[model samples]
Target: MRLVIAKCSVDYVGRLKAHLPLAVRLLVLKADGSVLVHSDGGSYKPLNWMSPPANMRTLSPDDVDLETGVVEQWIVQSAKTDDRLIINIYEHISDSSHDLGVDPGLIKDGVEADLQRLLAAQIDLLGDGYTLIRREYFTAIGPVDILARDAKGATVAIELKRRGDIDGVEQLTRYLELLNRDPLLAPVRGIFAAQQIKPQARVLATDRGIECKTLDYDAMRGVDDSETRLF
Candidate 1:
């Protein structure tokens, strides 16, 4: 990862035009070729970001840019779309690179892991007569959070997330794509199970023919007297 603190202005042009005025901000260039511009606030979400499969070029400031006190410019262009991001740097406060090495990815915390376990034990939460095949069912890409047989006896791949978002739907779609290729699981279906699912994610999941079920975390954990809700 490369991190740069710079007094820069950003302009994004593509489907929309947006601008971030000159200010000191953190710029992150990830190994995947993604770029994110972040302010000190807004928690972990970046103020602006360009997703991967993009190219970036550094160039000297033009005459017009120099007159505006711009010292350098970085042009990042999307590879798959018309999106483009331009960073106009007035001054670089700091630049550093870190060798993060291989990442182990996210470690499931107690609640998430426990939720998986409880759901695995109570496979019927997915549907009536659903029987668990396994938890952490191995796949070539990664483990499916839970594998089960639906009431109809079809293989069902379940992906559990603490908070379901579009990315979670994407992940489950990939798993279904791979799993359905196997002769044994050829007709595999997908279920995106989560505590709270974003409205946008629900739309995407439904469009993909994957069912979205919102789990009651407290009820699933047996801590709350309220009935576990599934939809």
Candidate 2:
């Protein structure tokens, strides 16, 4: 968890005031070495992308509230247009010294990395072709933290939460609807992964045909086992 505070210039301030807020910054690692900016948190905005439109940049934040100076976090999950990489930005907690009532690991950036690690383990255990997709926007329902998939070919839309209320069944469902609507993702199935789960969310998932799993050290250890399903 590294907290990087870029020096604010007049142009930067203008962009922040116009497009986002001034919170902390965070990032989510993507499959092709690209990253996603889950939340601008007012910390930083206007990130760069190296692709065909090389030097391409995006001003993070869906919109801004000039009156309150509060810019909502941006959600750019799985922005890969092809075999290229994408980068994510968000607020991050550098360490214990910066733990302002928030668990360092819970930071969107850190959580995304953990999700990547967990997914990597699962990939090792399950197989390759499965990729990590970062999701960080709060829709009409709630926030979607990450998405996992065998998406190079098939879809396995996994929504993740590092902490907090486990009443994510509805949230997951909403996201599933979004994922399903996309012609590229219509074949996707839904999976919910978190450090913990609520009884109600579990029951709802069972009733809705959604899959839920928990991340534990054992899951990581299971990687490299010959029993793994690798392509």
Candidate 3:
């Protein structure tokens, strides 16, 4: 990973367009080929970013750019789309790089942990011929709940939740974004599994091309009726 604090202006072009005026900002260049622009505010979300499957090229400023004070430029092109992010650097501050290895993923609480176990055992619930690759498929960002292969052998990342919400969908989206960086899983699909799913979450998941499944906890636990099991 590379981190640089610089005074730069940015512009994004593709399906939509946006611009960020010159200012001091943190630029993150991840090992997975993603680039993120962040400011001191906005918490953890990047002010602007380009996901993986991208390539970045640095070019010296041209004559016109020289008039505007652009010393250099970084052009990040997305391989999956026509989207591109252009950063025109005016001043350099600090730069550093680090090799952060794969993350072990977040520790699960009891219910989510139990849910993961149940879903992994009944991987077929996803579909016919689905096979479990493994649980806790670790990536640089975090671990996937359960990695599996579909009938066609494509990769699927299952995100288990006790109660599915829009937040879970966002979390799964992040995982999918990072997972797709791997050539072995370039076109990974996502499954948002939970005992209960909110309406908004379903809509967002569908929009993002993610499949949703509601788990019958009692059935998975071998209880004939849900009433027979105590919370």
Report how far off residue 105 is in candidate 2 (Å): 12
Ranking, lDDT, top scorer first: 3, 1, 2
**C-alpha TM-scores of all predictions:** 0.52, 0.38, 0.50
> How much lDDT does each candidate structure score?
0.90, 0.49, 0.93
Clashes of each: 0, 19, 0
Q: How many backbone collisions does model 3 have?
A: 0
Candidate with best TM-score: 1
* Candidate 2 vs 3: which has more TM-score: 3
Q: List the residue pairs that clash in candidate 1.
A: none
Q: Which stretches of candidate 3 lie over 4 Å from their true place?
A: 1-110, 225-231
10 residues in a row with least lDDT, candidate 3: 61-70
lDDT of 3: 0.93
Estimate the lDDT of model 1: 0.90
Candidate 2: which stretches are off by over 4 Å?
1-113, 120-129, 132-144, 163-166, 217-231
Instruction: Supply candidate 1's per-residue lDDT for 193.
Output: 90
TM-score of 3: 0.50
Off by over 4 Å in 1: 1-110, 227-231
Residue pairs in candidate 3 whose N, alpha carbon or C atoms collide under 3 angstroms: none
Q: Tens digits of per-residue lDDT for model 1 on 133-157?
A: 9999999999999999988889999
